[model samples]
Target chain A: MKLTTLAKTVAAAAIAMPLMTAAASAYELVIPTLDYRTGAYAPNGIPFANGFTDYLTLLNNRDGGINGVMIKHVACETAYNTKQGVECYENTKNTEPSGALVYQPLSTGITYQLIPKSAVDKIPVFSMGYGRTSAANGTVFPWIFNFPATYWDQATVFVQYIGDKEGGMDKLKGKKIALVYHNSAYGKEPIRTLQKMSAKYGFSLLLLPVDHPGQEQKATWLQIRRERPDWTLMWGWGVMNQVAIKEAASIRYPMDHFIGVWWSGSENDVEPAGMAANGYLSGAFHAPGDKFPLHDEIKKYVYDKNQGTGERERIGEVLYNRGLVAAVWTVEAIRKAMEIHGTKEVRGEQVRDGFEALDVSEARLKELGLPGFTYAVKITCANHQGPGKVALQQWNAKAKQWKIVTKFYEPLSDITGPLIAEDSAQYAKENGITPRSCN
Target chain B: MSPDFLFFLEIIVSGLMAGVMYSLVALGFVLIFKASGIFNFAQGVLCLFAALALYDFIAPGGWVDRWFGFTLPVWLGIIMTAGVMVIVAWLIERLVLRYLVNQAPIILFMATIGLAYVLEGMGDILFGSDVKPLDIGLPQGASDYMLDTFGLYVEKLEIVAAFVAAALVAVLAVFFQKTRIGRALRAVADDHQAALSVGISLRTIWVIVWSVAGIVAMVAGIMWGSKSGVQFSLSLIALKALPVLILGGFTSVPGAIIGGLIIGVGEKLAEIYVGPLFGGAIENWFAYMLALAFLLVRPQGLFGEKIIERV
Candidate 1:
């Protein structure tokens, strides 16, 4: 009996030995990026994916890995379509190297569809600029995180910027402001926020919708010509931005009075208009141009070695920087996760904890060479967007660059907090989501 | 009540102008269909290409930036654009449409779809994917001088577009009725085999018809592109013309104009007065629904020849 028991113990030890060794050896964190490398939006998508991949590569090459855990990233191209993005999410959800913490869909449409699924799968979705703005309320949407800013935050800042430009908030009392937007959920996101503000500010709001892909806007512009609105807020994407700018210019509308969201502002948006795009302003979450140290490092480490993803000149443009910033936030979240879990090897849940605990301070931003880029943001039990601020940048004709004019912060707690809560409750009721109690 | 009445009138007039724009695109499709019995799916892309070419020529500090030193004047750029369209027409006929002339209508239609991609790629390569302001030197600020008491304010661009379209239609009517080439075109369109037997070269007629279509597309491009800027998405306006073609006959110019007007005005009025009750954005689908309803009632469209198959 003793001899038989000894033999069984030996067999068990042989089976368990390799796994323990494997666990102690170098571990890997597999991150799956759902990228759109081709399609109607490839102009924006390709560069963003390139930046994302390059940043991951940068972490591997420069710092060896995130907290010594090498990241194994696999990119599945979705081509900016929602169905393909979901398919990619499903295919890469449980990929080897175990912890697939975050998924950035890069499309609001896809983000909306994935929100419920992500929550069920226990994987967090990071929809930075575009998504259901109410998803910013983390209490109901525990798995969805739209850090830095929400559409409502952007709308509030846009109004605040207009108020600032007019010298005071009182100047907005009787002005006619037009919201020329693409007729999609992403386009209509700021409507409720803008309408609410307009009601309070006593400004007239004209809602104008340009259909998807926004090529033909003669009727919309004709309305603009008819109404003669004092200011126009553009919520557009891809070719839509250029069309709006051109139409506004053709009508001889003051370009300075026209404002676009961050997605609406890019080198592609103005390159077509050239001189005609002068004085057009857009609210930006990050500054344009690649003057940041991280950019310089990318140039030195990546581009210099011909390891860059895009053309050398396009390395630090607005969209490219935004992509890099998105990567930074992601990696920082991972770092935070490692800090809390007391080990480099963490699961998707631990990564979520990290995101919730992120405290990106001004000092840390400056250290990262993203000075004046963003304020200190902290995600909490109820707030997923964190402290949001936007800067207004105008296209200068002489300098041929976007110059930051001023920064505006919305009254988040007073305005957005209640709205988010109410919206989350409504959304929870509709989606049959049970809100988590913080206590 | 007066404000609502005024708003209604404004919507109707504006919608009519939009209809004219749609008619211009529908006219290109009609021209191609009349000559070749194949719908030119690339007509919208052709419009976009022409407009982008014109804008690029005039925009300062571009590919030809050093040639003119600064910006080329509007008239010169427009003339150059016309020359470019003629070349594009020749190339398209020689390289694509000519080869598929004897193929099925579906095959020919698919060829135009291929041509659309080629043109889009070439356009993006040549002009880049940026939106450029199309400054065609049309009069501006006319909308401000409103006949307020009559509840009417006319935009100068709209006035210009109406006149240009009317003039083009008149010119085309005269060309088709008065010119010998026009007679040959009509003959070829009527009976291809008979026209070929009569010693009229189908190739020459095809080239001429496509050239004319190209010119019309350029004019339409300028009007629409100037209003909305020349971009890739500008080609989607062609979809708007599909319902116009269904409403009108595929071979009738007057049908195109009238059909465009009906669809445009109908959708606008429905949206303004009836839309809010149902939901806004009804205008987006109303045009197609109206056309579909019309097709159910009149399969040959308002002017299309009724096909009577005898098995």
Candidate 2:
């Protein structure tokens, strides 16, 4: 019995040893990726996860980690579920020594859940372009960062583009615009902003909500046929995007007049509808396709070395590039963090400081091999969201590529700014958070 | 006709067409349940897998093209996918159903749920988790002829799907009525012990029944994958079949068709006419509510055979 107990003790130690080793590896900067590679959203999630992981792998393979510090990428699958996302955060947050530097869940639902938790844990939740639009108010949401743009910002950009097409903002008057969206928190995000915009611009706003998975949209499309809205904007993800596009095409809804948010603009969404999806416009922050200098570098460092995460051909697809951009921001923030503290080993709290002070200028973007990709971003304590600029991209089915049809333009901040302040103030009051003074 | 009347007619026509698509999936469920008394929960996953296989076989730069150096024509790829589904059916009968033979019906149902997860995983592993556009040369977009002549819009693909579903039902009806194998399957379903006494092989019948069900899944997959790209969510389409089964009865083939039509029209009308009163998106739960009402009135379903169990 004593021998058996000794043997059991030895086995327990063997299992615990590796975990202890992992915890002790504090010298290596740990970045936890909450990824989804299965379930309904897997088609969209896989490419983004691949791009994110591949970029981090590129940093390790090409540059020997971020500033000679070996990066430990710990990936946890959330399956695009909010519950699973919270579970992943709870499980991976405290990895011993120095906890995870940052978390980019790439999901709006997950981002919403983590807003409060990040403040307590001192772990920065970088939602990038998706999350609570009110979280863009940095004073209220100190740990939550949705840089470059928010959903509200994107909504304004889409409306601005529509106005430009009709000659000017004044032309939007009396025009009926329908918002066909997924009936979820993520889908309902742009409604308040669009409503405010409609009230200001005199365009009648039509709300059409399609439930989750969004396969059966026959009823929704038939209504669109009856109503005959002038413009239709979709805020959808995964199969919802594809089905909506197909339904829109079947109704002979002029594809040019229909626009989707960035989440709906992936190749997966348009490819299903074939030539019918041609001329479908969508709001975008970055250029599409794998033609950038960063692509060449990724091919050399990641693909050639067989350390790639996804198919070689699908390197610069929209979602993949979104992931690459996410990884680029993360690494750039870590660099800033290191420079600020003058230390290689930085904790999650220090990373939050890094996020606030981040400034990716145009020259800096050129230096990073991604010139003219996206607008230059500068994150401050007062504004977690950077310049909320967006561009319009059109799908060319024959060429099978997305082309940026317009120059990068700014969102209507006059309306969005006040809306953000009002929404964030309400959120702060409800959550019992004393708004921090950025000054 | 008045414009409003024309629009109402358009809604009904569209609903019937959409109903045909739902019936196509519900048909697969009736086949498995009627033959084996097992609710095949993996039917939707089977559809997803079959579609993924068809895409991999036919698509340029697909698995067949990458590995074998040849791309299959659409028709040939479908035939090959049918063959693959038959093999999967045989494997399921041999490995899963055969072992659980004579077990409780719930046991068989649970096995299918397991089969679903396994098949979903296998599909992702084999085909990769990328959504692929499937084009089997079926007509898509608005039917210009109908739109111009009737002043009503109808999708060409949905029309094609309606025809395909009708043809499939006719073929299935004939197979069940005329074939000797069909008689054996019915006999096995009625009394397993009695069928065994009559020299019928339960295993063989199960394999054949599953194979037929699988082919039906392939058809449903093709139609749906053509509408929306074949992806992981294709499996979730099974949820749409539940209300159909409840209203139509789980064991009746014709019942699936009628149930699909009622649910389709009822939900569409509710969503369009009544949904706005309650803020829209009521179609998602409208069918389930109708199914619940049906259960209180007629539990055995509209076409289901009422079993008289003697005490």
DockQ of each: 0.20, 0.76
TM-score of each: 0.81, 0.96
List the lowest-lDDT window of 10 residues for candidate 2 chain B. B300-309
Model 2 error, position A363 (Å): 0.8
* Candidate 2 CAPRI grade: medium
The per-residue C-alpha lDDT of model 2 at residue A155 equals 93
- lDDT of candidate 1 over B131-250, digit per residue (tens): 565666776433655644464645567778888888888988888889999989989988899999999999888878888888888888988776655666678789989999999989
**Which portions of model 2 show Cα errors greater than 4 Å?**
A1-26
Error of 2 at A206 (Å): 0.6
Q: What are the RMSDs of all candidates, in order?
A: 7.8, 4.7
lDDT of 2 by residue, A77-118 (tens): 999999999999999999755689999988888998998899
